[model samples]
Target: MVGQLQIEVLGELNVRRDGQLLPLPQSKKTRALLGYLAVVGRPQRREHLCKLFWEVPDDPRASLRWSLYKIRQITNTHDVDRLTADHHSVLLIPQAIDLDFTNVASLRPGDLDTLDVEVLESLAAAFRGEFLEGLRLPRCPTFEAWRLYHRDLVLRSRIEILRRLVSRLWEYPERARFYAHAIESLRGDAASIDLRSEAPDASVSGSSRDVARGNASATANRAGQPGSELADASAEPKAGPTVGTPQARSQAIRFCRASDRVRVAYALCGRGPAIVRAAHWMSHLQYDWESPVWRHWIDALSEEMMLIRYDERGNGLSDWDVADFSFAAMVTDLESVVDAAGLERFTLLGVSQSCAVSVAYAVRHPERLSGLILYGGFVQGWRKRSPHDVATHEAMTTLIREGWGNSNPVFRHLFTTMFIPGASQEQMGWFDELQRITVSPDNACRLHEAFGEMDVSDLLSQVAVPTLVLHARRDAAVPFGSGREFATGIPGARFVDLDSANHILLGNEPAFETFIREVGRFVAETVQR
Candidate 1:
């Protein structure tokens, strides 16, 4: 049996036996040594430990040994054992102690509301101050760097988890206010470190008390880095499980055979004709909801169908292998999501570049599909060789590769203009963050490469299902001509060209209403067949 122990280090460090507080060793250095190792929990050599605490005299080797002896004596734990050394190499075995940090790492997204609420509460209460109190050593640059690295990682993880919890606010409305406050508090003044001038003003203010208690839920959400509520709410949860698994609310999963495969990650709501949504490059099943773009999309779709969307294999919650963004691989990923959702026949809705996949699915599986809908999409590449296009693609790819967060303002403006058009200040921030969450530069380049090669003209002619193609007249990324061509190629395909521009429709009433009217007509008319 694995023995159990409790160690809390929020404001002050406290160690407990089974349920009672235990007396710690006298030496300050010794307590600090044990506390640091327990929190880090990774195997380390003796030389490394000595370097971390430079206060330990010049002879780090002897000082390391002395610290080890003291740690064992104070804790009465046999888990700390010395490894065989080569030259200055050293290692410590921390297999015995059950640290709270490890427990925090184990929380998953699918846990019941009760358990998830408790875990979040406990973790929020743990990270009280810096890792160690006041053990300063001018010579321990390595320690300082390591400490900062771990501290940031912990903070990032907490933010991500809390974000997921908030996204599933539908599941536990009661826990929302508490988690929101905790998330905002933990974030401190991170928003003050602005990376762009024109940032969003989204905030998170909905709690059970707010909803049930009649308080106002905040209006817009922004990207997290620049003090946006959308950013805080949409941050991706750190690693674990795929789609409804305990650790993750949504996961990108792959199910393949030979050359055919499908990658899909989904957030499910209701059950009926499943709306298989093909998303533009970046998406987190959970994070996207924080953005108004996704909110409007889901609100419209879920009224009639269960929405199934996933990041393309190289984007969002999927694997990060850049070379796997080929069309063939993407089709396979979609198949996996369909199979996972266990839907036999359903509607397929393609958005932005994903229209390519929806068209392919219709041509290949017309018999298995209930209907098809395309919105703000294109059949051909935007412009063959405009220098502006090339520069935009290259610049965005470079920014993603260099680092996607708080770094590139040009890329943000370009994408915001393309996706959300005249979005509110908060709305633009949400779009910027959603794009960032989509994929890295390497992956984005691969997606762009795949998109460049897609020519679905031959396949469009083969689609026989009831199809509705909706395109914005002023779509910056995809021209109206492509939507027209798509409708022309498919026999009996109905086309509706809206006066609005922005690719994803951005909550425009007239455009959205037009889309719903056309799509609803198609779905209702076709289902009778």
Candidate 2:
């Protein structure tokens, strides 16, 4: 007896029947054609498929015929009628096969709020990944256009479901945050979708919360099963179970006094080898885990290592009203946090001005560090780079002092754009709030001034730890040459140039993927030694 036919087009394209996987055609164009037909869910003209997938081929019609024959050969083994073709058109018989994409496409906005919790959970699980991930036909412009449009449509639908789930599970903050994380992972910022706007009278029943919790538990159980595609599902959501998983929960905030007697707030999360992030100019130990701009980093890094992040002496949950905001104090803060965290040796991660602080620490305590990873770092600060930078710094500091906490995001927008030019509107909004709440206007100016005057050029050559330097090619905050200069100063340091404009990597950018992959590899190699 033939079993049910199921087509999965979420993560990787696959066709299964009777609990058996079917081999697809070797040609990507053939696979693309099959996926498009299944997703389009209607009869397509034979000529249209030919033009879409083989537009650049010399013999488009002949190519299509060969592809169809190969597809038929594969499908005929399972069920010949799975794919139906006439002389002029072709279609995947809807009754013969079940398609995840079609099921997802059938969902409406109202279903998100009104549907049973179990039903909503099933719909959420259906979205394993972006539509047709890693399936690209270089020369097929028509196919590519259609794929993008369909992908966007699926993304919108997924976002709507997630938004409504979050609203409906309002009392269950853990589940709400889980969906929020999924929404952000899909590059659909949850903040952009106002839950209130979606369902004004949305209310969750006790049974609904139980259903959602059960769904989360089921997801966690599936996360451990062998051969599961959990990693590829949605940017490593399987790294942990729910948003309230141990790593996602609030870390215990501890205070350590610096040499200058200023209190520095720090927290350690996850479990593995210690990896310390240098306290940059802006940080909030409490809000950072939930913020859109930083949560991705927190989640991804904590999955493999015990990530230690902290607020500098004058920002976030640290002592904001401080007497000192100098480079010496910054280094002291790092030293105190390291000691407080009780790390004999750990990997050091630094970005922006904190790169200098990290470099200085590595130099002062070479035996204390196992590896160094710096992004968009510079040995010399803006004022010391050139006279031009001095004037620019002065102007920026002036603006921060004058319009730092204004209700209007105009002044803050300038900083946000330069830092993350590719940030979504939701990200921009979160960053603006972070800036205002992280530190006062006076502290902002002081921080920028301190960054401008920072000069660790002489300390670069003294670094003794294995180092990896990364910089965005078009980083607006730090010049690409400056990053190169930093690498050049350190003997045998490796340098990677990221193709991005954002100084701070955004979650959705291609550069972030490269960054994470490389960093993971580097950390693994370093620990092996």
Candidate 3:
């Protein structure tokens, strides 16, 4: 206790130094900045800090410097530098502090169940109340948004622990019932207070298929719903969805709750006409940010326009232990991400399986779209391609399940080659590693099984958006005819044929360059200025 400083942020802003509570700075912004730096516990750029806490026409840099000085009241000591700020970035390195909430916040989605009971209970106890309680600055919208999101995160962690305790403490019937009641109470509050608008419905929705028939109209109604009211920008950022400020170049990965309450992770980059890339099988937002195979695609797209992308429900950075991996639910996920990203009207980009989903979305919510782009997509999935294709699809599913998570790269190589036969050794290795880390083998097999059954041929003719279709000539994963079918089937679609065998175009190849140019030109033409 003599050498340690205990800072509690799960509830209000409370810092104790050597068994004596310290008074916080008078300025709410300073106190807010202190909490933000402590929670992130990472070196944040001076530019980012300026944008996050202060605004223009008021000398934001000077205000930031003032705030740093105020924060030093608690952090400054003769010991090591707890609060480090320089020309480039600001960092808070607590010499001795409690990081239980930060540790829980950093956890991967659905990993709470994997943790030990004692640990969950310990983390659960940290939540005395809301995060940074009473710390809300309406003028500083970005900081307010961050605070609200972190609060929802605490809400989620609390509920998950209660639910886990209810299920695990079977022998302790009274204790189990207490936890069960706690979950209901939390859900009840979430429903009334709207901690997350999706929590109540997701509790009863179970699987996406079970509710698709009942919620189809509901999905349509919610698809075009607008984002929350933030003081700045068109859309406000949240725990589930974070949109970038116009001048903020860095990608801030955030979460958006799908209709089923599944936390779908999304990020926004660049500034301009928005482009929403619907989640596909191998999408990992954070992982693909610097990936060799996908980085070029992200970089090219972001430079041209604001690129909005998310990991689909069951894979990537999204919650893995999802109840539904159905085609209908994927449509819901797309709508959720779009609303969270806060675009009034924007181009939608669909690749592979998402192409079908985009078709369905275009048909359902044509008013929300400026244009639709389908790349390497099919009118019918592998199995539904024809009656004779069923056997082959099933066989591939079985093969992938058996060898998916194995150390041997043979299975991965076989699959990766089909998608990117033209890939270099480095690209191929990236693809292989992507499969192992982003998705579990069981979920992969389930998605494979579901994708094969997808039949959106009925929706293709119904698409009303300005449409563009691009496909490789000899893609081993999907047939060249599949691409031709989309162009022919859609009412008014333009098709571009790239002279490559790979389903996924490699960055070094000419086809990728053509792909970028065409997309940029089409988006520029279609997006409303």
Candidate 4:
């Protein structure tokens, strides 16, 4: 490619070609228009562009054409198609432009922990100031909103990158303190990124006003506290689809349709060898990101690997209106998520009911997986186990059907107690609310029934990949014998007994540390082999 175009909007609006600074259109509106197209990363309609820039008193179309002419002077070269417009729409080819904003645009919340130390330092140095510094268009409200919203996104990411840098550079205290003390004043203004602030969503077909608003009202409804693939949109076509949510800025929780046509939600984060955790239990991708129970789990796991997690078909952020609750369907959910994520080779992680799902997948697609990790899982469902277990499941079924959906925490507490008996009041309360909110009462019972009938014992021996089985010694939900069963049944499976009663593993206890330490070591070994 000849005549490379580079655009930097992280701090200032600087456009360059092949290391030579280029002059831009004198009009602030024209420069603002260029900034918008460069950051949006997609095609925009001509009429909408006219509305975003030119008002009715002016010849909007003629003015837009003039701006496009000026923009092309600086952008398109080397047959790169960097600036392209047809009769209907105009688009900037993001691939052709070395936009500096993308450097931080790609940084998500959990990403800093996984990034190399050098990479972290490099990213730290990239942030010069708020995005598009001093390029304020007070007259164009839509453009102003976009600029301000993105400024917040960029500033928040900058703060997080600095925070991670401080933590990582502790041995180099002088440098760490330099970043710490230098930016000590900046955090008060922008550190807390209010992701609740909505951005415009240019619809497939909408008027210029619609384009200008980007549907802020709609955006407010779609955007949750942080960027949740669950709340904003469910499905994505590929992995590493960048978003601006706090679960490391871009750990996009997206969706894909299963063969059965169920829309399954999944989140992929961090930067390393992949580890796909088959969805199990009550996991809301949005809520769990900030929750005490699952947040640490996600943070620790994503630290060393590109962790992929999903909501089940009938639970969490996945399509909850599903009909298929069969054992085969459960396995298929994991398959669909992994495929949607575009993972070539990953160590599969299975917890609780998903253990059976992971085992079955391993047997079917041994070449696609490096290893398997099973925690607090069972070889046989209650129905497939002893009569006492079946009886207990039958009793639990009655309780869930009646009170699982009730406002009272009594019924939910029963399930929560079993999973994390050693949990503090706060943790138990979070789990209680999660159980009630994640799934409907009918589906809760259905999930329980489906898990109870999972006869994966026959498939356990078929597991071809290396495996690790961990179970809390005093786990009240699933017996200690259950984890032992997986260890014995799967060939070359290593087992460890975590000394805790909690099935989810609270952060306060030593078991959580052991869990992380073991998983990290196992993953490292898997990467080497």
Which is the leading candidate under TM-score? 3
- Give the count of colliding residue pairs in each prediction: 21, 0, 4, 11
- lDDT, candidate 1, 1-529, per-residue tens: 3234566543345677666777776656666666676775545545446645744547877777776766555455555333223344433334655565665545433342345545655665666654444543324433443343334335544554555455455456556666656555653422211111111222334443332211123322322221121111121222233211233132222211112222234445534466778766877554554346766776677667566666566655444543466776666666655654456678898887788888887887788788888876667653344678667766756665565443344566576777668677556755665665556666766677677667677788789898888898888777788788888988888889987877767676588888877876787777667
How much is 186 displaced in model 2, in angstroms? 37
Give one digit per residue, the lDDT tens place, for model 4 in 150-210. 6755765676666566556656656666666534546344323222122222222223222
lDDT of 3: 0.72
Q: What would the TM-score be for candidate 2 when compared with the true structure?
A: 0.55
Q: Candidate 3 on 46-113: residue-level lDDT in tens?
A: 87677667766679899999899887768767874588888888888854465546676776545766
lDDT of 4: 0.74
> Model 1, stretches more than 4 Å misplaced?
1-263, 382-406
Which candidate has the top score in lDDT?
A: 4
Span of 10 residues, lowest total lDDT, candidate 3: 208-217
Better candidate by TM-score, 1 or 2: 2
Off by over 4 Å in 2: 1-250
Model 2: worst 10 consecutive residues (lDDT sum): 227-236
Overall lDDT per candidate, in order of appearance = 0.57, 0.72, 0.72, 0.74
Cα lDDT for residue 519, candidate 2: 86
Please estimate how well model 1 matches the true structure, expressed as its whole-model Cα lDDT. Answer: 0.57
Q: Give candidate 2's total backbone clashes.
A: 0
Worst 10 residues of 1 by lDDT: 192-201
As for model 4, its CA RMSD to the true structure in angstroms is 21.3
